[model samples]
Target: MGIDPTNPTGIKAFVFDVFGTVVDWRSGVAREAQPFLNRHAPDLDVSEFVDAWRREYSPAMEEVRSGRRPYVRLDVLHRENLVKVLAHFGIAGACEPEIDELNLAWHRLDPWPDAVDALHRLKRRFIIAPLSNGNIRLMVDIAKRGGLPWDAVLGAEVVRAYKPSPRVYSETAEILAIAPRELCLVAAHNNDLAAARRVGLSTAFVRRPTEHGPHQTSDLKADEAWDFVVDDLHELATQLGCAR
Candidate 1:
């Protein structure tokens, strides 16, 4: 039942986990946050500020995932978290428009250096899209700004659930009119791929050792024997038989 990395014959589409796998969210956010911080919180560390904002991401999603709150797009959750992070740092003078602009840091993420070209290569062979926790608009914005060529954006907002939610994987396959076995979930997070694997989707683990920062400890390597384990999107494209 193990997948063959070199020749994954049945996989018809490759869905990516965008945040860390395709785009460098941490660096991108920090870059966007710097000017804002310089204007407002001159004493704050840009990296710490970005990290704090991101730290709230999971819990915000968990509220919807646990059904304690109804489904809301990631944009809404991010704004709410941004307000909280600002308050946590004693930043209270930011106006709503300012907050809204800063919250869009997610939408302006820069892709990994190899991402765009590799995606173009992979797209030539298989359907390529994002199966991310980000909403459709957010995905579109990121793809547009990062120059990522996705066939479609499919994920949390589409499925009404987030990653590690079985429904996200199953429903994404349904949307593509393909069986779960014919879809491969490519991600930097081991947990995301593990969840996809549980739902019968093939998995590829792309290492993003500094996804959190230079000292990041989690997801530094694949936790399971994924169908494909590679150092970057280019490597995954190569293993998937994508042409240069």
Candidate 2:
């Protein structure tokens, strides 16, 4: 029943994890940040700067997730970290708008070479949407930038809850007017799929072992038995029985 469209039993939609799954956020974010870092802190090691920014990512989100602080989107958390990181690097004279632009590095990610074509193929057979922890505006901007053909963009902004939260999964199902099992979440990160599975959504894991570049230590392979484990989105479309 959860087979997305080619199987006799129907699965109506596919919810994708945008970052690192469909788009190469690690490389994209680093590329976008380099020029800004050069202009601000020319002597600084931009790669380490990029890695440091990412290092703060989980902790910042955890603060919000743990309710030690109120809910804050990744964008906000990124900015908060950027300001501190830049100051520590002795980067000065940047205005608020510049800082904000740097923070949006996540939004301007480049899609994997196969991402666009794969989604086009899958869309013919399933309703495709983004289900991510990114805020709505950020996710929409990414869709526009990366040419992601999502039927709808769903994000933490809509649910005020992050993935791994049952409420977020249920809210996405309700918005799409489909049952939980009818929506499959395709992701590169196992934790994301694990969360989707807990809520009854079928999961697909597309391994992006080098997503973190040389910085990657985790998510090197699918640790859990996801419904499907493929190398990329195009492969996913093929497995779901989409032709071409």
Candidate 3:
């Protein structure tokens, strides 16, 4: 059912997918990597390299989600993935200290221009927190760095499971002291919303087409009939009547 932008049913809180939804991870990562690549490996493509690093995100977490590996934070997984991608490009001579610095780029990512303002608007009507793959400290750090007004920081680390796992959604709702139906998951990724929907949460889809750069193909539009679909976070605030 298409939600009336004017009315948000029972929603008391909005749980967000932080990476691509609230911030432009692709550009943020590439911006950090390009300087190093230009200085050391000028022939390498920055955007392509950043996308390659991002593609490793899900699979790296699967090992932990499946219990094949013990629970670890996204920060650790990010570092591991960065190492692998660097090796894949065969960019030798880069040491662990330098690679680790690059991995921290995820922690310090800048928000989309509208992200902070939108969150401030939404916070007036709803308790806002990140339901991201990032760990609690990581999300909190990013929020502090970017001036995001999150009511709380919650994510995979809090639940000890990656997203798409029912526990992540259900536990987040549990923590917020709200019913799953009253907790809306706002994200740019369809798969994240699909999982949240399956777990009985309300959903809002906001597009971030340039999130993965020009070659991006996925999530150009909402695939499923989500409750709400808006062009930007601020638009979502207007749709939800949260604007002040």
Candidate 4:
């Protein structure tokens, strides 16, 4: 679909979910861990390692979501999760510096092949930024490295809360001084869009069929009546009449 030239839905901005949505975190992490895996545990499966690390993602964030842990950044959570996964694989005690370097892999993930072009077209019409769990620095780094062209960086750290929490969605709208209905949360994850919708933000579901690396069973299609559902951001732009 071509870009749309109208703003029929009244969406003033598009806030994105970065991981697995805008950027392909699963493959990116696997790619980053390949060399290290070859050197440390040559026989280990790279995808399994990445999946294990990601599997810990929600529970770690749940600690914060439930207020059991204070609002620590996602970077800290990711690093901690990485350490645990590495140790579980018997690759522990690998130099602290190297492990830390591996943790930074999240910051260097490549954008999806369509992400840059789609975002460019979408940006021409609406304000675009990452409303992600990634901390400000992480989001900023990804934007810089990937040329994502986000108008602002806002997310978990800024709100001091995680998504699926009403605060994260509501506070983002508050920060932008836009009504919840005026801002759209665009994501490849269903749970994320559902959360955003519950808090009154308009939602858009985009397809990222390979986001979880083929075995991905969820979010293959929209489960809710989202305001916009498209195959890609370019299609989203087209639907919103923001096509270029």
Candidate number of the best lDDT: 1
Question: In candidate 1, what are the lDDT values of residues 1-244, reduced to their tens digit?
Answer: 6776655577999999999889999999999999899988999999999999999999999999899999999999999999999999999888889898999989999999989999999999899999999999999999888788999889999988888899999999999999998999999999999899998999999998989999998998889999999998889888778899
Global local distance difference test of model 1: 0.92
TM-score of 4: 0.96
lDDT, candidate 3, 8-125, per-residue tens: 4878899999999998888888889988798768999998898899989999999988889999999999988988888899888887788888888888889999999999999988
Runs with alpha carbons beyond 4 Å of true place in candidate 1: 1-8
- Check candidate 4 and list the clashing pairs: 3-243, 4-241, 4-242, 4-243, 5-241, 6-241
Q: Candidate 2's residue-wise lDDT over 1-244, tens digit each?
A: 2543446436678988887888887788778888897787787777788878877877787777777888877788889999888877778878898888888888888889999999999999899988888898888888899898888888687888777777788889889999888788889888888888888888889988777887678888999988889998999998888988
- Looking at model 1, which ten-residue stretch has the lowest summed lDDT? 1-10
lDDT of 4 by residue, 16-59 (tens): 99998899998888999998898899999999999999999999
TM-score of each: 0.96, 0.92, 0.94, 0.96
CA error at residue 76 for candidate 3, angstroms: 0.7
Model 2 pairs whose backbones collide: none
Q: Give the runs in model 3 whose Cα sits over 4 Å from its true position.
A: 1-8
